[model samples]
Target: MSSRERVLAAVAGIAAVAAAVAAPGAAATGRHQDWDETAYRGQIEVVRSDDGPSDPTVLNGTVFVDRDRDSRHDRNERGVAGVEVSNGREVVTTDRRGRYRLPVYDNMTVFVTQPAGYQVPVDEFNVAQFHYNHLPAGSPELRYGGISPTGPIPDAVNFPLVESSLTDDRRLSCIIAGDLQTYNLTEVEYARKGAIADLARRNDYQGCGSLFVGDVVGDDLSLYDEVKGLSAQTNGPARFLPGNHDLDFDATTAVHSFDTFRAQLAPAYFSYDVGEAHIIALNTVRYPCTPDLDNVDGLRPGCNDPVNRPRYNGHIDETQMEWLRRDLAKVDRDKLIVIAGHIGLLNWADEGSAIHQVDQVREVYELLHGRKAVALAGHSHSIENMRTGDAMQGWRDLFGIDSLPFPHITVGAIAGDWFSGRVTEDGYPTAIQRDGGRPGVLTLDLADSSFQERFTVTGENDRVQTQLGLNTPTYREWYVARSAWNSNPVGAAPELGDPLVVDQADLAGGTWLTTNFFIGGTGSTVTVRLNNHRPRQAVRTQPMRGEDQFVGPEWSDPAAVAEQLVHGGSVANRTMHLWRFELPTDLAPGTHQAHVTATDVHGRRFADTLTFQVVAQR
Candidate 1:
């Protein structure tokens, strides 16, 4: 018998909707009964109304065939039939041609659960190609996220079949890339030259996949196809989400703000499993500008009326929130939960900035409780690993500052600063910020319930870049004041480069600049020696922002500042203008640090340092 007839004959005795509920731990919805019900009268139709043949020879419908047996299309797959088909709310089967259709709406997903015995095609990299796009004419110019607006859907949503398997434990791995907001092709090239090259060389990822959190291209949706081509550089499947710059300017409503994104990228809010973690990528940019949108305290309408709306801000709306709840429900409690988005939660690096806030971060955080969770995000073009234990533990700590609760890492941009300025040896901007983070991508290895984070610098060195000394309260006031006048005071750092000659007078009473370096390596020992030391003094405060005022454990001088001022608190404006250190020779074969001070071109002084290190074994 023919494939269609064979399939029908095989299930002809079966009911139209199988009564078998999916087994626990299976998570996947099983067979639909409609496959054998040839007597049923509901028709499967394809309606394409453009200036084409009245009787177009082909009916194009996007199909997502079940490949991994996970009941969801992971990547690279288009749906097909010989498989059971359903709209979730309705049931149907593919025609004798292995194609089927039920009523499709602007936002509906026409899916096919992978049949028990067929394989879905995969690319050269082994990534699954399992989902097809079904966009009929008269559908809104932009109806769903990632739909290509440049052309209409083709004649037929075809599925290239391979072999099939029933085993679901494929050791899935999804590559998570931070921001790549390339405003132009040049920036895209920068990304290609940098970590994109690195990704191309990697194939060990579980699921052998990659998902870019957001800012795929700097405010330009037109560059997506080129970005996709760059993604082909990788050895696995790739997916993407919408960032602030990916907004749909032509969208008539806020609901459609991510339309172009959906057409070109993956769903704005979707989930897939890799290893033991359920990774969900979200679109935090709620567009369709709203008037009362100046980083307000409680705003919910930002995602509803993006057009004619006031200012655009960052947030997760009710629709997405409800979806998140449903998505999380499907995940097992024992699995690690990883939530990746373009905007970070509680990012102090861009403190006081509204555009980078996740209006509903706390709500999402609550949903993933009791499960091992890590929130990975980007938008600031910087990398920070923040943790809170006490207050951040929620009501237990009253949301006050305590120990880090969980790690919240903000990944540096793949297209650092929109591929800022001149290109370096790597064909991209040396885009190393004075704050110490070099432009790069972050690699997270998750196994079971644990993960390790690695920041891969763009160029050859894989330098472990980090910020050294931030302004103490005294210096903070100075930097703040000078920064108001000089847009780049941080660049004009004071040059206290020379080693200090500790003398009796210097020891009597003096305050020194402290350096806080991040991304240090193993076996690294930070050592210090004064050219002279009548008083052996070194107080290295913990390396942190907004709180680097004290010296190391070696120093215990409370009056250093007061004595130096010759007047108590009156010297509030007095900043720490002098200090220095050298990179320890014993640092492990990785990144290291050396905090120092310096005087600017003018008489004014500023405190800053360096974040450098020895290379580690690849």
Candidate 2:
């Protein structure tokens, strides 16, 4: 090629990189879509060799500062003491010399818990590399090709760290994303335009970064790279937790269930300290669950064997449990403990499901009895902000638990009901959730131990929080007359026309102004004002006081069901976050405006308005 052609080609390449980078994030967000191959990325420097004599009994490592950012511990690089290292079982801190040793196992992951003051290294995709997966015997024959054999334990598994002021401050903004369960490449691009684009546009959350709480893919591990590529376009480092979908079904035993996950992402269960919060990401899913796994006696039969039909139970294995205990033992008593997992310890969406709720829920609560803590999870594909003292009959009947001891928030999914809905202008499905929440990401804004969580809906700004609609007798009748959605959606059903329009018979039959507060819980309140009249308080449907879940059309969100019925998705027949205000019986017939203001547990208020017509007759 001539010099002129070379210059033009270089300019075109630069423009392509610029366009891809600028398309995702806002200006100065400091995120990029593509990364230079040879540029030095901050990552845990693993200086190991296979040709040397190895010690399979124990592993040793040094946590040192990589001054040159070459992911290497040269002579000039000094040791950083007090860094905690774990072998997935025991937690030990480095000595003054920054050297520590631990007993090794065949299927253990050795990772350095990123300390608050220093930043760890990252890969090209900006995935923090803090752990080393040690699978000496590799894995059993599985479809995803679980962790390859590491041959032998290396001489040293040193971890590299670079000093940064990112986590040095007390105020922390951590993004908790959920269930990027992309089944195929098409769905993958859908995720890119949805929450991923939302994350890329923000520059905050550098302290704790983004913690994806499970269901990274929909049973296909090959999509791991695609999902990782999505993270590359984001601002902060990306961390992942394993869900039921992120498992190797071919693994007969639970030991190697997440070997491929460990090989691809970080450890299945790990902990990190960012600013004032100590984040503990737990592996709460037990694949091929056994009745023996449940201490609460909640799991059913036919879950013992995987070859026949593999079932998963929400229970943490003894290994991870012990590791959690050891890891938490190192944290300070007053610091905020953010316990994150795939299956929630207990949630409103799956309150009654023995297989969906954690068996050792009480055990986990007991462990953090006197600590300032909160829990975040995903997998139910619903948004639930369950606070302390919030009670559910299902939690009582299944786990014998009366009420929540701490705040347990179920962060909703990116793949809203498996991406089931009509295509949007953004080139993705509307993908409304089973609980009537739009696809979004959860952000925990913290100052010291105090925190206030806010959910940002996809393809919209943070101000969009509540969904207002009218639930009339007409909607109930239509809901009952709707097709058998379980099978192929076959059957003609008439739309409710205008959901806000209620006839005199409907008002007499009890019409209600429903507000589906996506993140509302026990302490939340929804107030409604009809035609700017006196505001009336809305009552929560579930009550969340150990009451059994109310299902069918009465407790449903008509607006969500309207979309779910026509677009093909999980029907929103039941949810704990719904609030209803009854309409006056002697209401004047005409169009009227209803003003809605929803106040969350933190006393944060969101206001919206809806215009509905009241006809004399249908």
Predicted candidate 2 versus true structure: per-residue lDDT over 1-618, tens digit per residue = 653354345334433443454433222334322233322376665666656436658888799988888887798888889989999899999999789899988778999988988878778676888998888788888899999988788878889887766666677688899999999878987987678877765766765678899999999998887777777765677899999999998888789899889999989998888888889999998887765664335356656555687888888888888888888889999899999999999988878788887878888888999999999999999999999998888888888899888899999998988899999987899899999998888989889888999898887777778998888888898877674533545665566677778889999999988999998988889999889699989999988877888998999987798899878889999998999999898999998999999999888899999898889987
Instruction: State the lDDT of candidate 1 residue by residue for 1-618, as single tens digits.
Output: 543343233232221112232111111223221211211111122234467433333334444444443433345555454444433234455655555545544453343333323434333223344444444432356423445432343334443343322212333334667787878766666776677766654444423256787888766777766676566555444667678778776666566677676655555665555546666777787666564543344434444444455445667877678767766775679877778888875553444444566766668777876778888888876556554331222222222334334667676677654554456564767654322355677766665656765566665332333223322233333334443434444555332221222222222233243332233222112333322222222333323333423332122111122221221111112112112242233335543334433222222222333443233221
Residue 447, candidate 1: C-alpha displacement in angstroms: 1.6
Q: What is the Cα-based lDDT of residue 229 in candidate 1?
A: 56
Best by lDDT: 2
Local distance difference test, per candidate? 0.48, 0.83
After superposition, the stretches of candidate 1 with alpha carbons farther than 4 Å from their true spots are 1-104, 109-174, 289-310, 351-355, 388-405, 433-435, 460-618
Cα error, residue 477 of model 1, in Å, equals: 12
The local lDDT score (0 to 100) that residue 261 gets in candidate 2 is 92
* TM-score between candidate 1 and the true structure: 0.60
Among all windows of 10 consecutive residues in model 2, the one with the lowest summed lDDT is 31-40
lDDT (C-alpha) at residue 607 in model 2 = 94
Report each candidate's C-alpha RMSD, comma-separated, in the order given.
Answer: 15.7, 4.4
